[model samples]
Each structure stands twice: as C-alpha cells, then as structure tokens.
Target chain A: MSDLQIKDAVKSYGNVDVLHNINLDIESGEFVVLVGPSGCGKSTLLRMISGLEDISGGEMFIDGELVNDVDAAKRGIAMVFQSYALFPHMTVAENMGFSLKLAKAHKSEINEKVRRAAEILQLEKLLERKPSQLSGGQKQRVAIGRAIVRNPKVFLFDEPLSNLDAELRIEMRAELIQLHKQLKTTMIYVTHDQVEAMTLADKMVVLEGGQVQQVGKPLELYDDPSNMFVAGFVGTPRMNFLPAEVVDVSNTTSTLRFAAENGAPEVVLPMTDGKLAIGSKVSVGIRPDHLHFSPAQSGDLAIPIDVAFVEELGDLTYVYVDTKAGTRLSSQKKDGRHNHGTTGYAVADTTSMFIFDADGHRVRA
Target chain B: MTDAIASPSALASNRRKIKVPSLWTVLKWIAAISVAVVALFPLWWMFSVVFAEAGVPVAVNPRLYPTSFTDGFAKIWEVFEETGYLRAYYVSIMYTILTIAGVLLISSMAAFEFALFDFPGKNALFAVVMLSLMVPLAVTLIPTYLLVAQLGWVNTMQGLVVPGLASAFGLFMMTQFMQSIPKETLEAGRLEGANHFQLYWYIALPLSKNALITLAILTFMKTWGNFIWPLVVSNTREVYTVSQVINQFNSPFSHTTVDVVMTANFLAAIPPILFFVFFQRWIIEGVQMSGSKG
Candidate 1:
C-alpha cells in the first residue's frame, strides 16, 4: 500500500471550473470516500487520480512520486466503474486477466492471480459467464475482481454499488468493507449516496459544488459539523433547522423563541457564551432522535397538539408534529408512544443541540 | 346462470362479426404475388435472352419461354476467350478485394479516433469527412484523374484502389457504431492498463465486428461494379472491369448478336450476385442494427 496526496488540484473545461483547489492527503491502507450529490465533481476527482482524466493544475503524489503526467496504464491504479464495465464479449476470467495480459505478465502468473481474485470475490463459478449473462451483483463482483487482479497499490471505485438493487447494494457494501480489511490497499471511493459513505469510509469527505464541506470520521461530522451544509447534508431525515430568535442570553445558556401557533413550547438551546444579544436572530438545530416523547413531568414543557401522523418500524416510531411553527418536524421514539402533546426532549440527554447564525455557519460555543 | 351464458355467447358472436375481412386476406395475397412478379420480370427476361437461339425470332410479342439455344453456353465461353472478358473478371475481383481491405483498415481507424479521442480540430476534421459524403464522387473525377496521372498510377490497380481507400460512408457508419459503445467501456479498458493500440485491437475492433463486416460487403460490391473510374483510368483492355466489358458487347446500328451477349452478360452478373447472396445478411441485419443503435 502507498499513500496518495493531491495538492491544489484544479480541473476546468475551458472557462468553467469543475473542481477548484482540492487538496487532500490519504494515508496508506485508508479507505477514504468522496461523497456528494451529482455534478459535485467527485467522480472527476477520482478519474484524475486514476489518470483517466488529465490534471488541469495540480500535483499528485503516489508512493512519494509525482504522477500527474503519467499515463493511466503506467499509474498502477485499477478502477471499478459504476457501469460494471466488463468487456461484454470476454468471459469473467478473461475480463479479470486482461490487464495482466496487457502488461505481458507470464501466463501462469496471470492465471494464478485471476483465480485468487475470483476466490476472494466468490466468483469461481462465474468464470465462463459473460457480463450479459450475469446478474447485476455478479457483474459488479467481476468488475471488482478485475481490479483486484491488477494488484495495484491504490484501488478506485466510482459508485460501484449505485447500479445494484437495494438489498444487493447493502450486501455488496458489507462485502466491500470485508475486502478492504483483507486487501488493506489504499482505496478512494466516490459516491453520491451518503449512506454508503458513512458506512464504508474511515474518512469521509463531503463535497458540494466542487469544494469540500467537511472531512472527518462519520460520527464526528454528525456531532460537530463545520457549517450548516455539512450538518444538513450528513444526517438522515436531515437535522431540522428551526428558525429562532435569542430572547435572553445568560452565562451558560440562551432562551430562544419561535412562534408556537399550536401551543408548542418555546425553543430553548444551551449556549456556552453570550455571542448573541437579546432580540438577535439565530437558527437552532436538533436531530430527530434527540427529541423523544415521555411523560410531561419527565422532560421539557408540553403543549397540546393534534397528531399529524405516525410511522412505526418494529423497534421505533416516528411522530410527526406540526409544532404549528408553519412547517412540521418529526421525532423518533419507542413504539406505543403517544404524546397528545407537541413537546419532546431536545435530542437526548447527552446530545447537545447546534446553533447557527444567519450565514449558515455554526455558532462556535 | 342463463344471463352469464348468454353474455359469453353474445361476445363470441360479436368477435365473429368483427372478423369480416377474409376478402382482404385473398386480395392481399394477389397484391403480393403481382408485386413479386413485377420485381422479377427483368431477371426472367435476362434468362430468356440468355437461352434464346441466335437465329430464332424473339418476338416483340413476348414469348414467356425460350425457343432454342444454338449458341448456348458455348458462345459465352467463346466470348471469354475472344475479347477482354477474362481479364475484366480478374481485374474486378482484385479491385473489389483490395478496396474492401483498404476500406476496412483506413475507415475503422478513422472511426475509432473520431469516436474515442478528443483532440484539436476533431470536429472540424469530422465535418470535412462528412462534407466529403455530401460531395458527389463525380465532381472530383477530373481532379482525381489528374492526381492519379501525376502519381504515375494510371491503368494500375493502385489508381483504382488508393484514391477511395478511406470511404466516407465506412467512416461515418463506423464512427456512429463505435460511439454507441459506452464511454465506460473504454475507460475500463484504460484502467485495465491497456494502451491505445491494445484497446483498439482487443476492445473496439472486436466489438465492431458487425459494422466492419457490413462495410466490407458494401465496399466490395461498389468497387466490383465501378465503371466510371475504371473506364476513365484503364486505357488498356487488360484492365477493364465487367461493367466496361458488358458495355462493349453492345452495337447501336448493326444486328447485335443478342443471345450470345445476353449469355455473356448473365455470366458477368454471377460474381456480384454470388457475393451478395453470400453476404447480404451482414449488411441488412448487422449494419442496420449497428447504425440504429448508434
């Protein structure tokens, strides 16, 4: 395994810049995921690292050597495309062994490497099958097997699981994690699915519009996002942003207020400093799980509400409350939970709420 | 129960009433056979003329069958020995094969380049190629003859084969077919460490077998019957194509030996007809499929 470093990487088509000033250092054996929405230039960045795309302005170092001008064949990197681009005419084994053949490796060595990769991917039975004959999951495995047979220092995957069905996507995700553990090669994966990024990556880079929003472990990003985009983008059901005004600020906490049309409780968040003066505006952030329903005496103030809806998934139930603050918000709780009241605990006992100013930057406490 | 039974019976009667077009079926067959006969009349007449005797009267009244064969196949063989017919056949065959080989090589390379790579002046170059398609081959006749003469290639097979090696139709057809191959396939091959030559040889070329075969068949046929360029360039009788020789069998004011000439003409048609029969499927099915897919 070899570390990869990219410094001041920029990609542009004529005047329109697609990726701007991207800088990252990935350690050897690290599984880093570049996750963002479509057109975020994450795939372009991965292609650049693979040397499939020309680097417009940047220095890229692989194993302590600059490789920006290297040809894709000389870069010693293998990629698994989202389309599972197995040569439709070649059988699975031939597809896996194609790179070795191109390198003029010994035929025996090529066969041994291909067999090993097939074993690792559980594709021994599929050696004679063409891509058109295989299921989507099987085709994906062959694509990965082809990459593994190259035995490159770095492995790149461009949304390899995006084409599989939901159940197969989860299965492949687990298998990929296991594959990484066994191979321990430096891997850079690009995907628009946040769930895949959170589950598979040791270090996740959330990009938006060609810029990195946040780079950290999954939970660190969930707990402390650098900005509102990262906060809203990194979570499921998304972190609810309630527009509030700071009513009063003390040494340790601030009382916040939002119009409670359905008799909902006042929005209150704890603050470590008096950054916002009285009557100043701010936004309060809270996770749905952070807000749970219990007896009115056990938690914060309660207000009457007409139940909007409920969703139960065996272990937990989601309560949709209007709060009558113009838009509705959801709270997750144990099943058989009914609060006839709108108020619930803010997140949890251990989870602290987030606050952001008007510019969508996190208000540092 | 009676109501349900009556409903199904009534539905059956309604279906039978809707099926009132058996007369259309009979008319359809009549129309189809009439069209087939009309299309085949020229071929039937060619056969009738080939077998008719030299002295027998083939009337304008149109006898449906042959009367006799005084010249028979012997006269075609005599023509084969007497005139430039044998050399014409050989020249046409050689030119067709050579043209097919050149078109396959040059046009496929152009197609792969246009389909895969992005370079400066690519669109302009491709536009030039498409512009060649729009320009009729006849417009370039004088210039091409002058260039061939300057190159000292007149009356040589090189004069016939080299000028139109990279056929615009072949390039256009192949480029369109190659473009239909997803970009991911090429990128995957690149990531597999295949160089440009290897990608072309092992991936693009193999994947484009249908289009290549189609272009080969069409190019061979076009060159086999090519008269204008061959007639202009090949001043020697030894270098004439079948089309030129077939024209030589004609005389405007004299009594042309019609049966002997027709037999010779029929024999002349055999090579291309055999070629078409052997390879028509590839062009009709494979090329059309590739073009539509692109």
Candidate 2:
C-alpha cells in the first residue's frame, strides 16, 4: 500500500490546458473519489496518475518515489475502465491471470491468485466463459478481478459503475466499498454522480472546468460549501438560491424585500451580526429539507410560495415552488398529501432561508 | 370473439384472394442459374479444354466436356519434354511464395505502425501510402524493370518478388482492419506489463489473424497470376512465373494447340484455388470486422 501525491500537476494539449495546477495528496488506505461533470479532466488526472497519460507538468509521487516518468506497469497501479475492456478472446481465468502471466509468475501462483479473486468475486463458475458470453455486470466483475490479481499499490477506477443500470450501480457501489475496505489500498475513483462520490468516498474532490472546486470529507463540503458552484453541486435535489434585496437593516436582523401580493409579507433574515446595507442585492440559499411549513410562526421570515411541481418518492416529497418574487424554489415536504401541481401554494418559515451576497457567496452567521 | 365464429369463411375467401408467386419463383431461379452459369462458363470451359488432345480440334462451337484427362496429359507431356515446364513451375511457386511472404511482412508491419502509433508526420506518411495505391502498377512497370536491371536482379526471383513486396493495397486493407481493434485492448496489455513488441505479438498479431490471412491469399493469387511485370523483369525461361511461362506454349500467330496450354494453365490455377479453400473463413471474418456497426 502507498500514498499517492500530486504536486502542481497540469496537463495541456498543445496551447490549451485541460487540467490546471492540480495538487492532491491521497493517504494510504484512503478512498478518494474524484467527482466532476464531463470534460472536467478528472479522468485525465486519473490517467496521468496511472501513467497511461503523460503528465504535462509537475511531479507525481507514489510511495514517496517520483513516478512521473514511470510506465504504468512499473508504477504499481491498476485501472478498471468504464468499457470493462476485458480481452474478448480470453476466458475469464486467462483474463484475470494475464498480468501475472505477463510478469512470468509461476503457474501455480497464477492459478492460486486467480482462484482467490474468483472466489471473492463469486466468479468461480464464470472462469471458463469468454467476455462476450458474460453479461455487462459479469464482464465488469471480470475487469475488477483482473485488477485485483495485480494487487497494485493503488487502484484507479474511471467511471466503472457508469455503464451499469441504476440497481446494479447501487449494488456494485457497495461491493467496491467493501473491496476497498478489504484491500485497504489507496484507491481513486472518478465519477460524475454525486451519490457515488458521497457514498463511496472517504474523501471527495469535486472538480469543474479543469479545476478543483472543493476537497474535503463529504459531509463537510455538503454542510459548508466554499462557493456557489460547490453549494449547488454537492447535494441532491440541489441547494436552492433565491434572489432578494436588503430592505431594512438592524443590529441583529435584516429585512429582505421582494414583490408580493397584498396577503404576503416580506421575509426577514435574522443575522447574528447585522452586516447588510439597505437596497443591496443578495441571494438566499436554502437546503430543501430545512424548509418546513408552519401554521403559526415563532421565528423570522415567512414567504408564501406557489407550488409548481411535486415529486413523491415514497419516503419523501420534493415540492417545487415559486417565491413571492416569482423566483423558482424547491423544498422538501414530509407530511400530508404530496401536492403535484403548480397552482396550490404553501408557506415555509425563515430558518430555511440561506442568504447570499451579490457574488453568490453564502451569508453565514 | 364474434370474428372467431366467422373466421373460417373469411379465411377461405382470404386464401382464395391471395396469389402465391410460385411461377415467378421458378422463373427467378431459372434467371439466376442462367446468370451464374454464364459467369462460370469460362472456368468450366478452361477445365474441359485442359483434358482434350492437342492436335484434335475441340469443335467449331467447343465441347462442353473434354474427351479424357489422359489425352491432355499426353499433350502436356509432349510440351514438357520439348521445354523446361517443370522448372518453370518450380520457379513460379518459389517466386509467388517469396513475394507473398515479403508482402505480408512489410504490409503488416507498416499497417501496424500506421494504425497504432502517432508520430511526427504519421498522417502525411499514411497519405503517401494511400497515394501509392492510386498509381497504376502498369505505369511503374518500365521504371521498375530498369531499376531491377540496374540492380542486376534481372532473370532472378528477386526481380519478381522484391518490387511487389510492399504492396499498397495490402497495406491499406490491413491498416483498415487493424484500426477496428479497440485501443483499450492494447492499453490493457500495456498495463499488464506487456511491452510494445509483446503487445503486438500477443494481442495485435493474434487478433489480426483474419486480416493477415485475407491479405496473404489476395497477395498470393495476385502474384501467381501476374504476367507483364514478371515477363518484363525476367529475360530467360529460367525465371518465368506460371502466368508468363504458360503463354510460352501458345503460338498466337499460328494454329494454336489449346490443350497443352490449357493443361498447364489448369495446373497453375490449382494453387490459388487451394489457397482460397484453406482461407475462406478468414475472408468472411475480415469483411465482418470491417462491417462493424458504429
């Protein structure tokens, strides 16, 4: 097992840089999930670490040895590709044992390693089958088995579960977590799915536009996002941001005003330190689950909302609404009928509101 | 449910209304067979003439079948006794084998390089190879003959084999086939500690067997049947390939003896036919590889 370090790593194709100044330290036995949208250079970063791609700049160290110039095999890393890429002509046993055979390992040792991997993956019955004969999930298992046989210092997975169906993706996510625990090797997994990053990562790095947006524990980034991009990207159903203006300021509270009908009053945000100037623009951020409807208010601000849509997913309901300013809003509804129309409106209390300045930075108390 | 009760009467009327194309099917079969026979008649006629006596005229219209293989053999023996027929046959086979082998080696290696690697001027080099394919071999004949003469390879197998080795068509075909092989497979091998040579040997070479076989068969048949290049390159009977030497028995200006020439031609055709029979499976596989759905 080894810790992998990337210092000031950059990649450029000719003049245009695809990855810019990427610096990360993955400790031994840590599962670091690299989550990003497509074209964010996450896969390219992984490939550079794996030595499959040439690093355009900076140093890479694996196990305290600089490996920027090392070949993939010599780097002691294994990768499971999104396409599986199992040798179509080779049987499962042959595919699993290929690396060992190439290294000129003894026949008995090759068989022993292959058999153990097969047993762990429940692939003993599939040892005789070719890749074409296996289903997608089975082929992926064979791919992982191929990786497992190498027993590398680090395992790189490039969207390994993206090809699987939703149910299989969930099942395989658990299997991968279990595999990481059992092997306890430094593993870097790349995916676009936030759920995968949250569930599978010991540490998560979210990237956008070839740059790291934030790097921290999953809950840390979720609870406190540094910027607007990380805030909107790190959560499910996404954190909602509503546009508003500061109407009145006080020592402990500030009133944010938006156009409303005669029955709806303007919402006030109670800040620990009154920090806003009147008439200044601000954005209010809210986690959907933070919003709760109350008949009698005991706290700050309440805004009447016009419910636009509802998604009732058995355990919880997501209510899509428009604020009094006609800004689109989403809030989690836990009780009563899960309303599913645009016309019927409801009220959510002030604690749900997350205020931001004009720059989309969150306003923290 | 109501329709089920009335279906037998309705079905009887529907069956009466339907007109099967049994007569048209028979007519179509007749037309197809006629076309096939017309296409294959030259091959059949060549076989028939190969077994007829040299002096006896086949017929004004030609015989559908030959009299006997023994008569044809006797005439071919007469021709052989008069000239070095067996020697020519030996030279032809040797030259064809060498040419095919060299073409396979050169073309496959070039194709592998062109298909797999990205170096400086790789596309420009590939474009040059494609450009070579557009140049007619006939146009290069005189220059090739002079080059062979300057090299002192005239009347040698080198004259026949060397110039034709790096066949542009073979290179193009093999490159297209090798391109379809997923790059991931090669990457997988590389990650497994297989070096460049090992990757080519263990993954590329084995997987490209179909394309190689297709190129080999096509190259062999083409070299075996090539006439003008070998004729222009070789000055003596000692270096004549089967195609060039088979014309030696024909007296085009006089009363031509068909059987002696046909028998030699018939025997000359057997090697390529045998080659094709052995490698037909590879041809289909090659075509299928080229036809992969996007």
Candidate 3:
C-alpha cells in the first residue's frame, strides 16, 4: 500500500513560480518517469517529492498520510542523486549502512543488511573500497545499494543515468528495470532523455515550462497525443509539422490545401464531427517514421522536398529534407540510402496524421 | 652532397641547443640564488654568532661558519641553567598547543556555517567578518588587552589562548575550502538522518583535513614565536614563554653575553623550522586549493 499522491503542488522562490499546479499519483510498484527539456521543472518536482525542496502550496501524501511538513529523513523515501553522492571517505559497506548506523541499529544488523545489499548490487567484491577507488559505474551501483539498504516506501531518482557514458547508460538502464521488478517499490524517476523515458517508464509524464503537458503510458502518448507539444516532444528526431489551410469540410472528411510551391498538395483527412471552418489555418503533424520516400498510395499525401542531408546510422538512416516552403523535416529510412541533393517525394500516411489549430491544441475528430 | 652538407649544420645546431641555456632560464636561476642568499644570510649570521669562540669579537670579524661547537653548547647550558629556560619552553609549548586546538575548532566550525548554511543575516554577517580583516591588529590590541585585564585574566592561560582563537584568515581560508565540497554530499547526509553537528563532524571535518593541517601549521608557527602579547600580559617569571625569556636577555638591564643570547634565539626557532620542514607539502596544496576555489 505504498501509494504516493501530489495534489496541486506548487513551488515558488519569492514571487517567481517555478512549478505550477502539479498533481500526480503513483500506485505501488509502478515506475513513473517525469521527463522534459532542461529547466522544465521536472527536477524541481522530483526534489519536492523527495522533501528536499519545500512545496510552496498544496499537499503531498505518502502511504495515505499527508507529509507536507515531514522531515526529509522521516518521509520514508530514498533518493539516488545524479552525482551518486557517496561519501568519499567511507567504504562501500559503510556507505550502504550509513542510514542504519544513524538510526543506531546494532552492528550485526547493519553488517547483515549491508551484505545483503552488496550481494544484490554485485558489490560484494568492492565492499572494502572507497568511492575514489571505484569506477563511475561502480560508484553508481554503490549509490543504488545505499538506497536499497534503507528499504524506504518510495524511491526517487533524479537523472541518475545522466553521468554515465552511452554504453554504460544503456547497461545501467537495463539494471534499473531489473531492480524495479525485484524491489517493487513505487519509483518516480526524472530525466530529460525521451529514449530512456520510453524504455524504462510504466507511465511517462511530459513537462514543459513548469507545466505537465501530458501523462500516460509511453505508447499511448506516442500514438494518440493530447496536444502538439506532446506530439513533438515524445519521439526522437521530432515529429514534422506542416502549415496548411482548411479548404472544405464534408460530413465525414475535411480537405486541407498546402502551399503551391510544395507540389500544390491537397490532403483530405477523415473527420466524423467536423468543427473547423474553411480558411482556418492548421498544422498537420506526422512522425518521421510515417513519412516514406516512395510514391503516394490510395489515401496518402505526397509533397516534394529537396534532400538536404542523410545520416547513415548503420541499420537505419535519417533523411533531412527541405520543403519548398522553407520548412526542414526529417524522415527515418531503413534502406540506408545516400540521397543528398536529390529532390524526392515524401508520402505521409493520413491515418496517422495529427491536426492542431493555431494555438497548438489538438483538434480530434 | 646536399644531405651531407645539411647533416653537419643540423648536428652543430643541435649541439648548440643542448649546450646553451635560454636567457630566461639564466635569469630565473640568478633571481632564485639572490633570494636564497638574502634569506639565508641572517640565519647564517645567527648560527655564526652562536658558535663563535667566547670573546671572539664576532661583530668586528664575522665568521661565516661556526668557530667552536663546545663554546656555543657550553654557553647554551649556562643560559638554560640561569634563566629558567626549560620552564619557558614548557609554557610556550602548552600555549601553542592549546591555541592551535582552539583556533582550528572554532574557525573551522564558523567556516562550515558560513560556507554551507543560509540564515537571515548570512551575507551581512559574513561581510562584517570580512570587514574585521581590514582593521589592523594594532588597533584592536589595546582594547583586547584592556578587556582581558578587566576579566582579571592578565596572567592566565585563557587570556593567552582564548582571545586569539577567532582567526579571520583561518575562517576565510576554511570557508573557501569547505565551499568546494559538493552540496549534494551534505544533502545526502541530511537524507540519512544526520543532524547539522553530525554532518560537520563526520563529513565536513574529515573532508577539511588538508585545510585543518595547513591552518594548524600556520597557527603553530605564529603562536610559538609570539612575543608581544606575552610581554604585555605575563609580568611573572612562571608564565614567561621562550620568546619573552629570549627578549629578557637582550634587554638593556641584563649583562648576558652575545653568544648566550644568540643560543637562546636559535633554540626558540628550531620547533617552527622543523614543523615547516615536515608539513610544507600540505601548506602548498592547501594554498593552491584555496586559491582556485576563492
């Protein structure tokens, strides 16, 4: 029953508000990731949940108890910082057993718990070594071991993988998933890396400008985003947005006309309840993978583009093209072709397209 | 033919490069030797006077080296017997040890607070502390002595040790060093249920070992050689430090010989010299750390 809830939480410094009206819930054993770009208040919200930062307004509950004023140590939560803040003078065993030692637990009990955590983290061989003697990956493992020894009701991770190298980050990402399955504590992790969020989170939260843009399962946000911000932020290389004008509206479909310089393309998308008036400006959003270099099919929209550059990433290549309207778009290709300086047609699947009005709000049919 | 001709010139150039030092290198050596001679000349003169033959008239015919070890040592024994030199040594050692302990503990704790925590008047209070450094010590000496006298501690160890414990330079140095410790480390301690004092003791204190050693050495050297405060406070023979006793020999009323006076000065200087010799590395390291951080 180690559920956590944050109700309308606000964080401010003097009069400048940094986090505005954040509300979230975490059930037992669920992995939630709060992700956004730098300064998006994701780290601030995590600090508030960990009780390191004070909540300027609203309530926080852990295990059904309001904990707005509780001390950070008494909140029954452990955090693994991005810096892996292991005491440099203490050995691995001593660091893992620090909280227990502070609690005045007996020597044998502390030793046993530390030993167990070391075994779990595969740190038994390095128990006698200091942090300065360990590698970056080992130090991160010891930090996790320290948290595991506490057996807190919840775990907070603030971009813990940001310090590791690319190969080691992938390795530790897998280890974190395994640790979550083994421990089954309610974990709230924060990061700005969408690939990490997509792979590790049971529920992903997208935040921008101190506000949560959307919160849902990773694929749900990817497949059916609630707003243009969520659609653009959730995927790698970003989704392509093209400006268009609504030309006509029927009972079941709406026709949009792109600029004449872009092959004068017209796309008629399915709409059950059309509320858009003619001559209204809108942007059509499509993921990079949904755009293909082949010719258009029955219901696809085709637009001419100049291939600006191609990035060949072994198994997959990314094609960055410039449309005639001076819009730069990226499309993922699996053929690993080098099509630089070649003008080509990009066919966009209309079924997977997203439509947004001038204010960046989704217009669902 | 061109290769053979070029080889000899290249060889000659390489030989000249190896044999001739740069003008900058020559100037650096000259400057270093000049400073060394200026610093060491006084020490050599002191030793030359200490070991000169009795009634040798060293001022008229100064010897660069010792004339006789036996006369110098015999004079030292006589001075020790006549002037309570051993008791002065004990008193000076105790004063230096106690003052060093007090200064390190007080200043390091002050530094931890000033560097790590935030309070209502944090910046203003630190500004005041920094301002205290600007006021000359001579200005405070009379007032401080008057306060000590009013407390009826003119000849007490507390008067000697307590008044000098709040070192502005030490607090400033230590605060700079402590600020370099990552705040995340202290926050980790906070999350582990450690209080402020525990954090200071277990975390901050251990991390500040180099700065502490550096401060201790500086305090040790300063307190060991202090003469003015003891002269102002200790009018009795029992509380006299080595520096006071050394000054007593050079006083106008005393008839102590030059060799005996120089012997006392030489003995009083050995502890500081040995201390500097032993811990010079930490002082350099601590200074570099403080420099970069500050």
Candidate 4:
C-alpha cells in the first residue's frame, strides 16, 4: 500500500539547481534503488522523498496522499542513515521501541513490538546492551530493527550499508534484500555503489549531474544502455569507448573504421534507419564481459593492443589493454587469451559492441 | 624500541617518549609546588583567623591559633544561634538551586535551536548571544536593578534568580557541545515522530549528560558565590544570601567579628568543594565518549 509518485520534482539551493525534473512512480512493494556517483543527487532525491529535504518544486505523493508539505514523521516514512543513527544512550530494545513510545503507546505494547523486531533481527540476545556495546554489523541490524518497529509505509535507506566493511557490506546487502521480501513493503535505497544498485534493486535509476540518465531493470540497463553515461556507469570494470569513423554506407549496413595502428582495415556492421552518416565521427563501446578474444588476427576488426595489466577475480580475468594508437580498453580474457608481453595482442570482437554518436547518444547496432 | 634508541635530551623533552624525570624535572616539580603553596596561603590564613578568639585586641597581632580548636566551631554555632545567618544560608541555597535550574532549562533549550536548526537571521541572533558574553555584568548593573525594582521584585528570590539566569556563556558552551554531537542522531529522533521539544528532551539531553553536568557545576558555583547581584537586589536581612550576609560580620549594626566572617567564608567554601568532589568524574571525563556512537 506504499506506492510513491514523484511528479516533476526539482530541488535546488537558491538558484543553484541540484536535482532537475525528477519524475518517478514507485509501485507498492517494489525495491527501487536510486544510484549514482557522489554529488549526483541520489541522496538528495531520497531525502526529498523521506521529507528530510524540502522539494524546491513539484509534487510528491506517498500512499495516495500528497506528502510534499507533510512532516517527515507524519508522511509515514522511516529513514536509516549511513551512520546508523542509533541512540547511544538507549539499549537495543529501547532504541527499537523509541517511535512507539513517542507515539505514547503503552509500556507492554512497546515491549511486545520491540521484542518482535528484535527477534526478527536476531537481536534478542543484545537487547540489554547499548549501541556502543554492539559491533558494526550488530549496530546496523539494530538500526534496521528501529525502522522495522515503526512499520512505515516506505523505508528510505541512505547508503545504510556503505559504512560496513566489504565482506560485511555484501552480507548486509543480501540480508536487506531478504528483509524487503519478508516485509513485503516498498523500499527506496540510495547508494553510489553500482554493485549495490545492481544486486539489491528490482529497478535501478542511474543518475548523473542531477539528471536521470536511464532507468530499467539491472540487466536491462547493463545489456542495453540508453546513452554513453548509462553504459559507462552501470557496469563493473566499465565498458570501453574508442574513437570511430564511418567509412562506407549502403542500404542496410555501414563499414566502420576505428582508430588503430597503421594498416588495420575497416570492419562491417549492420545499421538500421540510416541514423549514422558516412564520415561522421562516432564512439564504439565494447563491454568487458561481452568481449571475447576474436579468432586470430582476422582483419582491421582486430586492433593491436599492448597489455597494461591483468586483474584476476577468481572466475574471470580482465586484461587492461591499450591499442597502439593509444586508445585504451579492457577486454575479458576468456579461453586462453593470456598473452602478456611487448608484442601487440591483435584483438577485436564485433558480436556485441555498441555505437554512440558524438553527442553520446546510443545508436543501436 | 625506537624511543629507547633516541638521544637522551630528545627523549627527556618529549612527553610521550619520556621514561623518567631527570634532575631538571625534579626542580620543575619543586618550583610548581612552591607557586601553588604561595597561591593558597591566603586561604590558609583565612582558615587560621577563623580559629582565633573573636574579641582579640585590634592593635595587637591576633593569636595564630586559639587555645581551644573549638573556638572557631563555637563561634560559627553562635552566629547561627544569635543571628539570622542560618536563614541567609537557606535563602542562598534555595535561590542558587532555582537559578541553576532556570538557567539550564533556558540555555540548553535555546542552544539546541542555535546548534541544530536553520532559520532567518540565525547567525545574527547567535552573534548577539556571543556578544553578550563580552559585556561584563558590572556594565548592566544599574539598568538591570532598575528593571528589577520596576517589577516590584526588589527583595524577592525571583528577582535574584531570574536576573542572573540565561547566561550567554552557558548558552555558548551548550551550543558548541551539542554541535559536536552528530546531527544524524537528532534527525533520527525527528523521524521517530518526536518534535523539536522531544528531540531536545530525549536525544539532546541524554547525549549531552556530561555537558549538562559540567554546566550545572559551573552555574551552581557561580550563583552560590555571587556577591554584588544579591547585595544590590536584597537589603532585608531575611533575603540576604550567603555572600551578602557574610558582610554583616563587619558590624553593620554592632561590633565587628572577623572570626565569624572567616568561619562563614570557610563554611561557604565547603559546599563547592563537596560539589566538585562528588561530580569531578564528569569534569575529568573529556566532555564525550569517542567513535563507537552509531
């Protein structure tokens, strides 16, 4: 019952606009993640929805009620801060029961609600300990417990697990997903971590410079990005962009030549709708995971590369490569492409590559 | 090991690296103790005078110590018995407690706003509070007295306590101390459906237990030992505070007795001393706990 609709929402400090025309409709029980790099306005958008930050313009509705002018508490939203924001003086049970007590609930009712949340969080044993006595992971659980007791319409988490260590962060991330499923409530989580956005979100909104770049499911954004920024930001180890020039165009296909070492010929790519004109400067994008070592030195489709470094992460190896013309790119070195030397590694794969115009808008290949 | 291998002079000069005191260090301790003793000699002299007989000849040097040690105790008991000095003691304690309670309420509440909230002219208003700290009480004595008289509270406890409550110094200390507390904690309180007052009462107050204790100590000591305000505000002996009534030993209506005044001074010093000893743990525990806060 906690669906949220934000219409033409804008946020600014004086004349300096920080978030521009943000429009989103979140369905009930959906886990939506607003994610971007630092200063990209994800936190601001979350704060606005939580009613912590005032919306400079436009409307916000939560649970079919216009909440733009409502106080944070009355808006039926609970926010978990990055710092956890647990009351240090109160024990775990008291912290969990604060909202209920403030609502003037009876002592027994408060205790029952607190006990329920503690049991769910597995914090029953630590109920008597203060926030300072708890470990980092334990503190975060208590923070979530505090939020759970309220049973707010929407749960707003502002990088709640960013403070945890990497291993703990992974563990907490999985737990948060499970918690959302168990509660069957709408949750809006904000983070700059793409991995968090990809893994935890049912739908991900990628933002950059205070504007919505793209929004889709995790793999949808990964497989088919709307623009160059979305393509570069959504994937891990990122997609590579190389300077490309259109050579010859016919009815349905265009021959494209990319910047490469001397004597590399052009490659053929199928084009639709005649979107790219001949001699137009464009950028070619290749995903690291999508790339394979193309069959041995086929044509100009293969660029001569010198290996800069190799990062082996268990199941996959990422080879950092720089073409001889100084165009840098990374390729997934699968199927024994482990040639590391001064000799140029001629590599190319046209099976799954992207093309973007000079304006950074993607033209489907 | 690196510290042990360091040069002798370097190690001696460095506080962290220093192992033991050298010849120079022993001399420094002796010098510091000498300065402290010289500074405390006046208090010792006052205590000594409390023991000497009350009616000793004015021209002669008083006996260093009376024949009976109970002379000071006996004289102190007589002052309470004969004079209204005991009532003065009661009045002082009552008003000092009231004044501190009022000041803590007003200052901590106001400071919470200044530290956490945003509003128009916030800095300008805060600057005015800061500026009041620089204006000495002496400068406002006449106008303040006139206002107290106008209110017809000249010799009442309210006039005495109310005028001195809400000090800029206390407000500034509270604001700065509360500012050091992370804003996220209070914001959490807000999300818990707590309004500004509840946030102050529940989150700010509990988090600032040390600061409140420290401020309470300062306020209690200041109002307890205050002289001029009480003297000017109250002329009736019934309303006389400890500091004001002690002047009566100089013989306002009759014979002067330095011994009883010294005894009063000695008794006055006791409460503050006990107060410090009781709450010194808070004063010593550096204002706050460290990083473990969520």
Cα lDDT for residue A163, candidate 1: 91
Q: Which digits, one per residue and each the tens of the lDDT, describe model 2 over residues B1-294?
A: 255465687879988987777998989999999999997787788878877655444566666777678987776776677667788779888987898789888887888788987889999988998998789877888898889899999998888789989788888888887898888888888888899887877878778887877777667667778888878888787877777767776747634466666777777777777866787786566546545210
- Per-model B-chain TM-score: 0.85, 0.82, 0.89, 0.82
Q: Which tens-of-lDDT digit does each residue in A152-221 have in candidate 2? A: 8999999999999999999999999898888898899999999999999999999988998889999988
lDDT of 4 by residue, A1-365 (tens): 48999999999999999999998989999999998999999999998998888999999998788988999889888989999999999999999999999999999999999999988889999999999998999999999999999998999999998888999999999999889989989999999999999999999999999999998899999999999999999887899887779988887788888764533568788886488899998888888876544434653367766677777765677877667777667878655446455445445556577889999999985
lDDT of 3 by residue, A1-365 (tens): 28999999999999999989998888888999999999999999998988889999999999889999999999988999999999998999999999999999999999999999998899999999999999999999999999999998999999999999999999999999999998988889999999999999999999999998999999999999989999999999899999889998999899999867766469888976456778999989989998866432333787787778888897888988888877888889887775444777777878889999988999987
* Candidate maximizing TM-score: 3
TM-score of predicted chain A against the true chain A, for each candidate: 0.91, 0.90, 0.96, 0.95
lDDT of 4: 0.84
In model 1, state the lDDT of residue A218. 86
- RMSD (Cα, Å) of model 1: 4.0
User: Model 4: clashing residue pairs?
Assistant: none
Give a tens-digit lDDT track for model 1, residues A1-365. Answer: 99999999999999999999999999999999999889999999999999988999989999999999989878889999989888998999999999999889999998999999999999999998888999999999999999999899999999999999999999999999999999999999999888999999999999989988889998898889988888888877777677777787888877777555535456555677657778877776777777665534334434343346777776877876655444666677766556455444332332356888888888867
Q: Which candidate is the best by DockQ?
A: 1
Q: Say which docking band candidate 3 falls in.
A: medium
The 10-residue segment with the lowest total lDDT in model 4 chain A: A291-300
- When 1 and 2 are scored with lDDT, the better candidate is 1
lDDT scores of the candidates, listed in order: 0.82, 0.82, 0.88, 0.84
lDDT of 1 by residue, B22-132 (tens): 888989999999999997777777777766666553565655566555555666777788776888888888888988899998988889999988899999999998998
Poorly placed runs, candidate 4 (over 4 Å):
A260-264, A292-296, A335-340, B1-21, B39-69, B251-254, B283-294
